[model samples]
Target: MKILKFISVLAILVILVFSFWIYRSLNAPYSHNKNNQYIQIPQGSSPGQILVKLTSEGIISSPIPLKIYLKITGTGKEMQAGEYLFNSPITPLEVLSELKSGKLRTVKLTIPEGFTRFDIAKRITGQFPQNQAAGEDAVLKLTEDISLIKDIAPQAKNLEGYMYPNTYNFPRAVTTQAIIKQMVEEFKKVWKPEYADRASELKLKPHQIITIASLVETESRLDEERPVIASVIYNRLKKGMPLGIDQTAVYIAKMENRWDGVINKSDLESNSPYNTRKIIGLPPGPISSVSESSIKAALYPATTNYIYYVLNVDKEDKSHRFYSTAAEFERGKAAYQTWLKKERK
Candidate 1:
């Protein structure tokens, strides 16, 4: 009986030692000198398969403790698939906890202050080809091919100006229609119902507001100046004056495929509806995407008596001193020339 008891104790000790060894080995961190790396867990890979992969990749010391830990923690059925980044030493236990939580990597995309529907469509297309989303051609077709967008945006003629500019995180499996709907819905949410009523008061169409907003968006990168520039467009319109926006000329040049880097005298005289330098009132449609600020500026312009503005000579970005006469504007223009000379230097 004594010999049997001694043998039983020895067996228990051996089992405990092996269990400890497995846990420590599997849960050990990558060494201090280890390189930064990422682990990709393929979709639907079982715990056993993942363990085999990790062991082979040198991410874990051994699969034994990993399997044992999963079994012990009741997480064998909870692992998820995605790419995981590890900059510092991370233990198998840490990785398992993160994976079970389904924390996937995310990327950021920034749409600038001014973008046209066409420009935005191309940008979305570039990102979607690699993912599950519809290809660019298909999405753009949905825009002009009303059948594709009717379900997404009933009010939108084409997807033009409907895609709201903002940072977005597109999941790997997100569909094309889903992406378009999200952007248009976001734009709808920002547009106030009262703004429509206000447009009625001004006898202007909502489309006209968007057109002016696009001009404001292109006119200045300075957020504070958009409303003031919008006021200039509005004041010019009230008096039946030409908008004379250089951006419109550029747009015409781009459309005609004659655009060089610099705007020339011929572009200013181009006979296109979008040629604001030649035509009266706002352009036919929005030339580019607009931001909320520019839209608000179009809705409510600055209350000012002045209609003329020129870039400040000493400081082009500094607010223009509003002017009612060309002489004042010319003086401002002279200061702008001196500043331009200094800038070129």
Candidate 2:
């Protein structure tokens, strides 16, 4: 009986010691590396190998405790391989959680609404890896391959309005093609079947709807104002009048690789089919990326006689004042020009 009692007490003591060790290993904050240090775990790496790598990099004091903890918990099989950024003072448990999440450390690239293909290409070229022909021009050329979006935008000459603008976190080694592909895929996700039905109901092609949406996106930032701007575009098109959107001229300058942050008179007078001032209908294609709100606005514009919109300098939100007559538009334009001059001063 004494021997059995001694064995029970020893077993209890061992359990208490193991529990304490695990609690310290998993919960205790540890920092042996520089703050925000990154480590790459290669594909197909075993849990043991990964734990050892972390120990060698001083990300953890030792991997033995974690190994024993993993053995007890049965939770290491889901760890993913990727570049991981470990912030200092992170617990081993926290690190394990991050690994299981499978979200590799990524560099975020944000493409704002109304950003043209040129804008995206330039941003991608500057931030991501490029091939031997590494240049902004080369990156722009990749967007020309419309095979990825050909199903929906069959007549698309290039992926101008198709690269959906959003902040995307990509792996460090992500190629320009992969990045562009992901953006187009995101656009597909946003361009739902209902949008297609609405476009058909309005007697507009998918391409035309996207083009009008792009115009609306550039014209107004306010969701409420986008439908109004879309109405203006449709109203002008129905009247067989030029769209006269200045952003198309800006897009032209960008296409010519001479956008010097100023829209020259030459740009306004350019005979490019994309020049909305010169063209009678919608530009040849979308001039910029279209937000879903802009797309919705194009599909369902406010029923109005509005054929013109000018920046409302009086409003704090920078919304537009819509007008049905040239005379009303001229008055709004005069106020906007005055505000512009004063701001320049």
Candidate 3:
């Protein structure tokens, strides 16, 4: 009887010790050198593989206990795969909870209004250094594939103005082509079917409308002025006169890879088709990404005979004054030059 009692007591004590160890292991914090670490749980990674990776990275002390805990709690099969950020000294339970939450790491990229495809490519490269192997040149090369925008803009040379500008959250390992596709898809969403009918009414193709919208976008920041700017462009086209838009000179400089923000005399006189000062019609392509308001203005221009516009120096807002006659335009031009010289001084 004494022997039996002693054996039962020893077994109970061993059970208590084992239970305490399991509890402590589950609740104990992991040891890590870094305060925060990013771990990529690759697709199709098994629970065992995840445990091994966590243990190897010093995110968890022992894999066995975590594996057992996960299995017992039915969370082992629920582990998701993606980029996960882990703070140091995280408990096993917390780690499991985080994994179960399915919150993948993402980078927020904001493409402001009027950003060109070239500008978008530069921003993407800056945001994702891991893609350094494919620099601006490589990205530009990818934009040349017009298949993504062919349905909406069959005549598009490339996705110049079709890359919709908006904020996007992308995964860390997303491909450049995928990002371009997403932007183009967003543009499609914003482009309504009615715009196509309006394009036909203006006797213009979708690409031409987008090109005009780009010109209007670069010329004015005011939404109300976009239609007026669009009217000026249309009037010039109708009269077979050169658009003479300074923004086109800037676009030419960019195309030749010589843009320095300051337009030289040569830029205005350049024989490039993109130079609106020298060319009689619309540019061969869009100069920049356009906004919805600009697109609307391009489709529906205001009824006006004014063919000239100069920056209105009298107003604090950067607005323009329209003139129908050459004499009035020259006067406005003189005032603008005077203001320009004074501002420079």
User: Relative to the unseen true structure, what is the C-alpha lDDT of residue 163 in candidate 3, on a scale of 0 to 100?
Assistant: 88
The lDDT of each candidate is 0.74, 0.89, 0.88
**Native RMSD of candidate 1 (Å):** 4.1
Question: What's the CA error at residue 203 for candidate 1, in Å?
Answer: 4.1
What does the lDDT read for residue 1 in candidate 1? Answer: 97
* Candidate 3, lDDT over the whole model: 0.88
Q: Taking the tens digit of each residue's C-alpha lDDT, what string does model 3 give over 1-345? A: 999999999999998998788889889888687456678788899999999988887788888878878777877878888777887778887888877766678889898878887788889989977668778888888888999988878888889999888899998778888988898888888899999999999899999999999999999999999999999999989999999999888877877888888999999889988988877899888888888999999999999998999999999888999999899999999999999999999
Clashing pairs in 2: none
Give candidate 2 regions above 4 Å deviation.
1-31, 63-76, 85-98, 129-133
Candidate scoring better on lDDT of 1 and 2: 2
On lDDT, the leading prediction is 2
What is the clash tally of candidate 2?
0
Better of 1 and 3 by lDDT: 3
